[model samples]
Target: MTMHLALSALLAIVLAWAGLLNLAAPAFVRAEFEKWGYPPALRVLVGLMELCAAVLLLWPNGQRLGALIGGLVLLGVVASLLRTREWLRLEYPLVLLAAVALVALV
Candidate 1:
């Protein structure tokens, strides 16, 4: 249980940080989205979902829902990376997927 809580906190922090970045939509993020052929507004939408997932993850009764949401978000990321042929960038999301799975199970 302690380990589960610790991992949950860590994952929530990472998700929150990423959510903020997506919401901020800095130049690099904008450029990346543009390169991927995504509309500028998509970043804000993704950020909002991420923030929602992070909040759920932190709620004792919401972890399962959080994991489900987080998994979907990460899967979208993985699919995007695959679509863009950004092979090298796949590792991060894959790792996050594993973490999400662990959090869900443990």
Candidate 2:
């Protein structure tokens, strides 16, 4: 249980940081999104969804839902990176998705 909580906290923090970057319209995020052919406006929506998922991770009852949301978000990210042949960038989302699955299963 302690390990589960720790992983959840870590995932939440990472998601929050990434979400904030998306919301802030950082140059790198904008450039990456543009390169991936995603609309700039979609960044804000994804960011908000990620923030919600992070919040959901704080409670036992919400953990599964949080993991589900996080997994879906990472799935999209992985798909996008794959589509662009950005194999190197695939590590982050794949790792995050695995973490989310761990939390969901445990």
Candidate 3:
């Protein structure tokens, strides 16, 4: 149980930091996110969603719903990441998997 909580905490931290990075450094993943011809607005929206989700994810009863949101966020990235195999691969998907796992176990 504790381990699940700990893992959730770690996942939350990762997402929170990722949100910060994306919001602060849109260029970091701009090209990758744009690969599907998505607009810059999309990238901005994803960052905002992630930032909000991270906060929601930290609260006790919010975990499950948070995971759902986080999963949506990752699913978007992973779909694209799979196509590119990513220049900065694994980190996003791995954290996403962790979020999913936390949802399952918690």
Best lDDT among the predictions, by candidate number: 2
TM per candidate comes to 0.94, 0.95, 0.78
Model 1, span 22-50: residue lDDT tens: 99988999898898889978888889888
lDDT of 3 by residue, 2-106 (tens): 766766677678778877777675665776656767787787788887877777667878877777777788888777776776658768586676666566566
| Stronger candidate by TM-score (2 vs 3) | 2
Report how far residue 62 has shifted in candidate 3, in Å. Answer: 0.4
Candidate models: Cα lDDT each: 0.89, 0.90, 0.73
Q: What's the ranking of the predictions by lDDT, best on top?
A: 2, 1, 3
Worst 10-residue stretch by lDDT in candidate 1? Answer: 64-73
Off by over 4 Å in 1: none
Where is model 2 more than 4 Å wrong at Cα?
none
Question: How do the residues 49-82 of candidate 2 rate in per-residue lDDT, one tens digit apiece?
Answer: 7888898888789999988988888998999989
RMSD of 3: 2.6
Ranking by TM-score: 2, 1, 3
lDDT of 3 at 95: 67
